[model samples]
Target: MSLLDQQSVFSAMLQAGPFAVGDTPPLAHPFSRETKAWVQHIHGNQLLKTKYRSVRNQIFDLLGIATYDEVLALIHDKELRTKAAERAYLLLGNMFGIEGTGQEVIRHLHEYARTADDVISSLRAKVLAPYSAHIETTNEIVTTWDPVELLLALFDDRYHKKARFEAKRKLALMGLAGSIDQRERETKIGEKFLTFLNFLNAFVWSPDCKIGELDIRYLYSTHNRENFSCSAVKVLSEEEARLIIPAVGEKLTLVKRRRFRDNGADIPIYVTIRKKEPSAKVLKLLRKNEKNPATAVDDELGLMAVLNSVNDVKRFVRHLTRSAARAESFMTLEDISDTLTGGEYRGTATGSSGKTSMLKFFARTGGMRIEFILHTNRSYLNYIYQRDVAHDEYEVKRIFDTGVIEFLFPPDIYHLDLQKIRDHQLAWFRRRIEEN
Candidate 1:
């Protein structure tokens, strides 16, 4: 076998062998800090994070159970997997980068099927097979659900032969609903309290929020955890802590979170839906507000202001596609310009071929630099080059020294719809969901 494969087999054998019963070290630190760090990396990664709705979604993929960190803490608690199949399921998911709550739970109802009748024979048979016994509905396109029974069914094994109904149900829902900031509080504290207050107050954190903390030793060094404490974790929430100390000694702490704010952390995007008000009216509201929206730099690297690093656009195209009625709710370029005192917003471009592109700030919460690219309006020359092409070209050229500018506005430059962009991101929760 290849070196990587050999190492994996060795590791599995180590994990599956009669580990604790032997003279061997029992694979001390069975999991590496890399695993912990990678999870933390996902939590800190703004782009990957923006793809997820909350931390619970990540936990579902990371840990088969909502409280994966709890599993980590089990090192201190000494919980063992009496049922290896379910443990294998979680292990394989982690090894293969297939952690998200995806179509698998629904698609494999019978494929690779197993049964409880064989649980007593082997860990593979017991855990994997018994799980198949609790099949509900299966389809290529699975409906999203929060079924308590489904989760309980996963734990059916020779060891955990009978499931804990209420316990399993609450655990499943916690992973389904919890956010990243909530995940952070399991270790540190700051944003969580602010978030809980916001949920109580009815306002919430900015979508793709940016937060940071600085290193105080040099006053402005790259590693300033102390100085940037308040800004470290971006997503925040309020919650009632519910931690259960399993008799097995695994402590599961779940906080149901609510509340948020625009703490001006460093992040790439800050999105908020404009409800009821016409897209044009929303700009007027922002324009009239005296509190200027903070940029990624104000609270991050202090290099580029957050405004320079991010674009605040109101466009959810997938929603528009499914509901044609919502199309009219989109904001126009004029509205964006009017919203800022001197906002430099080039018109959005859409192509006849349905492509798009635009200029935007790619890095946020850090350097907040700007770059031009084609997105959304992938081939929308027909949208911008029709009868108004020459006239608009002259107007734009008069505004820039490059008497010329390529329009990538229709599709590739500036377009983001959560549902549609799935095909373009790396996810642990869902498999190959990005359709493009």
Candidate 2:
């Protein structure tokens, strides 16, 4: 029978008498003559099964089967009831559209059958048949990668050796002979020892980045914008100063105080010039996993420009791009401005505030790559707050989620007050949501 006709039969059965104790409390009123006939038809056909007393079972009973085992047996048996069994299989497959049973049946069919076209082949074909065009369109725009494959590559012996060689070469090129020798010595000790040494080196030695013959004084140079003055600047070296000055100047006009004030109010722009320092974990990641260690670590000699508003962000990017092209300093652009932050609390603060832009680009001059990050005021504030105040709390929570803290620390460590941190995050989230 069609599914609609079968549903009509079940509805009629429910309207009939002998309602089970827990099977949806009985109606307050008496059944009408029409309802009585429906009940009679259901009971007369032995549609009710006391053992399997669920609405699910009632539907299955309508298909002439008592249990899933019976259905499986029929599908597998080929001698006595070959034709009858095929018909039964077809009926069960048709019932896959009935919500809960559909998923269970698909999973079971996949598990039992060797070939794809066994029991529910027709159902699969019909259901997915309409989405071919949509799938094809999406395939053109999306880039897919396999995390499992990347993880496996990390452990491959040849891959590990290549990564190590690249790491040593980078250090040598940067004129860090001691760090290179240290890595070589560790390699001779043992694989585990080499890994430990590499981990230590990542934390101990910062990248030696020198910009050759590039005047970057403009980065640290003070400039006045109406009532706001962005004079807070630092220059590490002459070469760094040379490189940073020009890079910052390119986008400096767009982020000026006057342009920002035109939108609403003037905001301060904080610029910093310094050598990029990779964290121990980041260093280890590059040394052990990255195929091209050079590209993996950008921002060696970095310049960060923090300003207010989304408009300033757009103008900054355009100016930076134009400036880089004009000076022939632009190498590559890693525009992760559109990428959302990770974690359960992600999209809570930055995502909802429309302040999630983070643009990174590499500008090369004489074997030195200078990275720049442009941030909106809200994002900059959020980043500072999280990094300074909530970092420990977030890290602890992450470790707890991974179940590693229990193995490493005492139980009391887990009892640290996380409620306040969670509340703070929630408040930010709610505020951003409301604004959006």
Give all TM-scores, in the order shown.
Answer: 0.17, 0.27
**Local error of candidate 1 at 235, Å?**
38
lDDT tens per residue, model 1, 1-436: 2111212211111212121012211123436764454456457545444443353364354344555444433323324332322454544334434435545432222121221111112212311122233321222112222232233233323112122222232232222122211222232324433432333123223333323211111111111122111111112212211222222211121112211223344222222111111111211111222112121111111111111111322222122122222222222211212212233335432211111123333221111221212111111221122222222332322212111011101112122232232222212111111110
Q: Local distance difference test, per candidate?
A: 0.24, 0.34
Runs in model 1 deviating more than 4 A are 1-436
Error of 1 at 65 (Å): 18
In model 1, how large is the Cα lDDT of residue 51?
40
- Steric clash pairs (candidate 2): 214-242, 215-242, 216-241, 216-242, 216-245
Model 2: worst 10 consecutive residues (lDDT sum): 140-149
Q: For residue 35, what is the lDDT in candidate 1?
A: 42
The residue-by-residue lDDT of candidate 2 on 237-263, one tens digit each, is 445544553232121222222122223
Q: What is the lDDT of candidate 2?
A: 0.34
